[model samples]
Target: MRRNWIIAEFTYDDLIAVYIVDVSQVRGNLKQIDNSRLDVTYEYYPNDVDVFIFQYSVDLFMSDGFPILERPILNKLYERKSLYSRSGYGRVANQVYFMVEFPYRKCGLLSYLNPREEQLFQRWGAKEIHLTAAWDGKVIWRRFGYQPPEDEFAILGLRYQHWATIHGIEYQEPQNINDFPEEFLKDDCVKLITMYKVLEECI
Candidate 1:
């Protein structure tokens, strides 16, 4: 049950810890990533792998400011299950890899997303999710809960006044979980999109 680091080209220097999500329970617990087990190459890691999902969390410092710990999913290894696309834009997502980056801090490319990444998130019932600097903006990160309630960057980006009018949280980002049968939020999100200032003030 142990191996050596096989994929050598994609190692991030500041990575603090590696974890594998054990879905054997409700979703699952994060098992610390074992560098020794990194022995499997990408070719086999996502290919022959099945039955468990992995998340890599790293503690990073953005700049001379404070140190914040954010989770950039390194890879989502999904077990091969029957897949059907309702919207006509569906395809088999063997496994998905996510690449993350922090524009500043001199830190380089944080991680990589392999394929069908978004589909996997939607399938398992994520509230709202995001990929940093990835065009989609906060639209994705809002999955778990409320994430600052605006589709703008964390630093210098200004919030668009039309947030409420934008769309409901469920609609902007929908999940397949039973908890949120209506994954799309109501017109509240859309309305907020238009009046971001008001929402900001209330928050």
Candidate 2:
């Protein structure tokens, strides 16, 4: 009935939302992620952990403007790939987690995947799907037909410092979402989408 937050200590602040993908409904969604030209890959982890990783570069801001968001990710792309290759495992993931970072503002991630990737997951048995992002980013998700969970941080046993560490970013844990820095809250933040709704839509 509820989602699980899989928090890992990484070079970046990452809060992977874990979900069980409906075996029957994921085929089409898989196709969508595959068809889209995004660099995506998944690694298998033994003992029931599956790691899915994806990367896409976009020019969200002018080529020269410091590009606060892009720099860190762009720089660590190779390192991440290397790390996943070493520790990631392959299996019919009954549970899946996605950590995607959107263009600036600050601190949040996305779960938007292309067709091929989704297909691979479906083929493997991706049952549970989890999403994590900044509090403000929930607004962006709503625009995309996603209904987010309320108070995910409290519900998921997660906090801002954990998120900051996962992404290797500086994080000042806010006592309340409203207390977030105006600049950071100006753009996307973390959020999640459940598999039940995903199935409902596919149906």
Candidate 3:
């Protein structure tokens, strides 16, 4: 599939802005610019054959045009560049692995990015999204409908028990990801577990 850059406009927190979907194709070097509002840039890196690394950074400004925060908020590494099917076989699926770092959690950035990400997935014909949820991501990604595999859940249960023991808290064997306590997600004792979300008929 040919790679094409996309431009999109978004309105969030009463702020309106336009951002490029793939900035690397256009900007070869980072240059300082005046921050009039929220500025977002997406970058694409071809890491290997059929694998790509994608990232987006944000420069946030207040309603009064005061710069608040500027940092990279999301990174995704994915494989299988396009949809393909072998003779007598069904369409093959691929996965996009991602990590997020949002300094301002309440800024509604994730809400703005989720749909755009789904669009990207559709373009790549990816059927699953995966991540290693740690720290706040454990709860955040769970809320976003990502779930750990059963085997990983069992391992998480063991880690949860150990964490509870160390904190002198009552331990209840977690039946699922939701069974884990919210407090445990905020701590470093819990092991980072693989979580995945299966997309519905992206094609």
Please name the candidate that would achieve the greatest TM-score relative to the true structure.
Answer: 3
Top candidate on lDDT is: 3
Full-model lDDT for every candidate: 0.27, 0.31, 0.54
Better structure of 2 and 3 per lDDT: 3
| lDDT for 113 (candidate 3) | 55
Segments in model 1 whose C-alpha atoms lie over 4 Å from true places: 1-52, 68-75, 82-203
Worst 10 residues of 3 by lDDT: 24-33
Off by over 4 Å in 2: 1-41, 47-120, 149-197, 200-203
lDDT of 1 by residue, 166-192 (tens): 533223332221122222223223222
Clashes of each: 44, 42, 0
Q: Which 10-residue span in candidate 2 carries the lowest summed lDDT?
A: 75-84
Reference-based TM-score of each model? 0.24, 0.28, 0.58
lDDT of 2 by residue, 1-203 (tens): 11232213221111111222222333322322221222222332322223343322222222243332333222001111111112442222222223233433322223332233334334333332233333544444334333333454344225445555666867765543443444433433333423111311121
Residue 113 C-alpha lDDT in model 2: 28
